[model samples]
Target chain A: MRLISTYLIGLVFGLGIMISGMANPAKVLNFFDFAGTWDPSLIFVMGGAVTVAFIGYRIVLARPAGTPLMEAKFNIPSNRALDGRLIGGSAVFGIGWGIAGFCPGGALPAVGTLNADVLIFMAALVAGIFAAKALQTLTANRAAKATA
Target chain B: MITEFTPYQSLAGGVLIGTASVLLMLTLGRIMGATGILAGFFRPMSLEDWTWRAALLAGMVTAPVLMLAVSGQMPPIQVPISKTMMIVGGFIVGLGVTFGSGCTSGHGVCGMARLSPRSIAATITFMIFTAATVYVVRHVFGG
Candidate 1:
């Protein structure tokens, strides 16, 4: 039952991406083109997402403990620092998005459409994730050793 | 009707995406972050986690295919880079998500929705950098 709900949620999210034309990497790329034929659709998409999110967060956070379907709380995060990792990572992401026109959320549906470029992007993305995890582990070990 | 996606459509999409993220969390106790979902492939299987993650991924992949089936076709994509560039770009984004601890959906959607300051900063940084990079790559380098 829980699995079903999760799948349904993912489906809705993907549908949203498709309907918003976010599945089209070209459309996303056009939004970045400031001096050229700039498309403002992404702004609208962001606006819509933000609006829904505002209300949604309020309702979810108000709940005591987890929601009906899950055991854990609605939101969780350990780190809050605006450090170099955040800045550097974001810069790299931007460069990639600007060049490929595919972010993670937008890339999933693109792959479904059998776009060769999206598939390649997804592969690279997976590799990057593993690389980051390895670095994170190494950093944690170094910190632990320093403390010990 | 405008050929382009209108505000109403975008809003509707946002609602759907937001709702799905919430619902998935409620059902599975898992944040609907794509990086986590994709990473599950390598993790030691607890049957429960695997089941939902697979379902989540399937749903995402299938939704667009279903749309294409029903809607007949979508507009042609306009990627500016060659296949190699796209691959490199993907790696960069993947790296960003890992270091930032979340991707756009994870940070911009779930994290921001929770009023997380880190997420907000990350989202802004991601968007600004993305815009700046796009400007340089497309306009400056003409790629």
Candidate 2:
């Protein structure tokens, strides 16, 4: 039942991405092209998403602690750090996003299109993720050696 | 570069996304960040964790079939960049999202909704860089 619920949620999220025109890299790129053919539609998408989520979060959190339907706890991010990795990583992501126009959310649904380009991008994305993980491990081990 | 302003559809889509987020929060008490979810699926800690993630991914990958039924056409997916660029950009994005601990859905939407300072900072940084990169690509390099 939980899996089904999660699948349904994922479906709804993907449909939302597709309907918002975010599934189109060209459309997303146009939003960033302020000096060229600019489209302000992406702003509305963000605004709507943030606004609804803000309100929904309030209502959901208002429920008593440990009252979640299917889980024992609310697995929310508790980190409050504004560190270099966060900022630097975001900068890197932005440059890539500007160049490729496909964020993880946007790209996932587009995978259904079965386009060769999409497939290639997905493959690269998976590779990138694993590479990042490996890099992190290397850095952590280096730091541990230095301390030890 | 030609694109139409689609506020209504975008808003509706955003709402749907928001609804999905809220539903996830309610049921599993989890955050709905696509990259994090995808990443977790790859490096799952347990069978329970892996199953839900797989389910979500299965739904996401098959969503276009739903679109075909509703919209009477496949969702338009246009990659403006070359295959080489796709690999480069995809790699950078994967690394960034992993290090940053979130992407648009995670930081731009859910984190911002929660008024997370880190998320706001990350969002601002990414937004600025993205616009700058676009400026360089479109005007400077003329790509």
Candidate 3:
């Protein structure tokens, strides 16, 4: 049941991307172009998403206790501090998106649609995730040893 | 140049997607994280968790087909890469999602609203990497 619901949610999300014209790499690439022929349609998509999310968060958070699908509570972050990891990661992601014209969410539908470039982008994205995880584990161990 | 959809179209679509995500969470108690869903395939199938993941992925893949039947208009896809390269890209994205702990939707939509530091960081990182990769690939490599 849970799986079915999740899949439906993803389907809707993908459909949203497609209908919003985000499934097209050219629209995304145009957004990044800035000078040549800027496309600001993404701004509306972002705005709409943020608006809905803002209201949704309020309703969800107002509950005496709220739990996401897997957990028993909303995983709200308590810390607001910025660190090297944050900055470094953001830099890398932006560069990739700007170049590839597809972020992860936008990439999935593209993959299903069988866009060759999106597939390449997705592949590299997975590789980057693994590399980051390996590094994270190593760093965690080093920090643990230092503390010990 | 990619043609832009009107604001009405974008908003209507956004509403459906956003509402669907909320409905999924309320009904099933799960966040629609794609990387996590895909990862579910690697685990034992007997686990109840696998059932939903498979269903969710199926829906994603099939939505286009359904749309084609109804609308008769599939967007033009121009990836400009080989199948091998695409696979490689997918792996990197998977790895990034794992390390980052969420993809753009998970972090950009959910995390950002909740003021999650990690999500903010992840979102920013993801965006930056995207931009840099584009620059390098399009300019440095001249692809």
The most accurate candidate by TM-score is 2
Stretches of candidate 1 exceeding 4 Å from the true structure: A64-66, A72-75, A145-148, B1-6, B74-76
List TM-score per model, in order: 0.90, 0.98, 0.78
Across B1-143, the per-residue lDDT of candidate 2 in tens digits comes to: 58889999999999988888888899989889988998999899999999999998888877888889877899777677788888888888888888888889999999999999999999999999999998998899998
> What range of 10 consecutive residues in model 2 chain B has the weakest lDDT sum?
B75-84
Candidate 3's DockQ is 0.44
For candidate 3 chain A, the 10 contiguous residues with the lowest summed lDDT are: A69-78
Listed for every candidate in order, the interface RMSD values in angstroms are 2.7, 0.9, 3.4
Residue-wise C-alpha lDDT for candidate 1, range B1-143, written one tens digit per residue = 11253567766777777777766655555566776677775563698668777778778887877787888876345566688888888888888888777777888887777777888888888888888887887778876
Candidate 3: residue B59 lDDT (0-100):
70
Cα-based lDDT for every prediction: 0.74, 0.88, 0.63
Give per-residue CA lDDT, model 3, range A95-125, as digits (tens).
5455555667676765676655765676676
- Positional deviation of A19 in candidate 2, in angstroms? 0.4
A1-148, model 1: which lDDT tens digit per residue? 6667666777787888887767677778777777766877777776677667667656665667545446554435677798998877877777777777888887785677777777888888888888888989999999999999
DockQ-based CAPRI category assigned to the predicted complex of candidate 1: medium
Share of real interface contacts recovered by each model?
A: 0.67, 0.80, 0.50
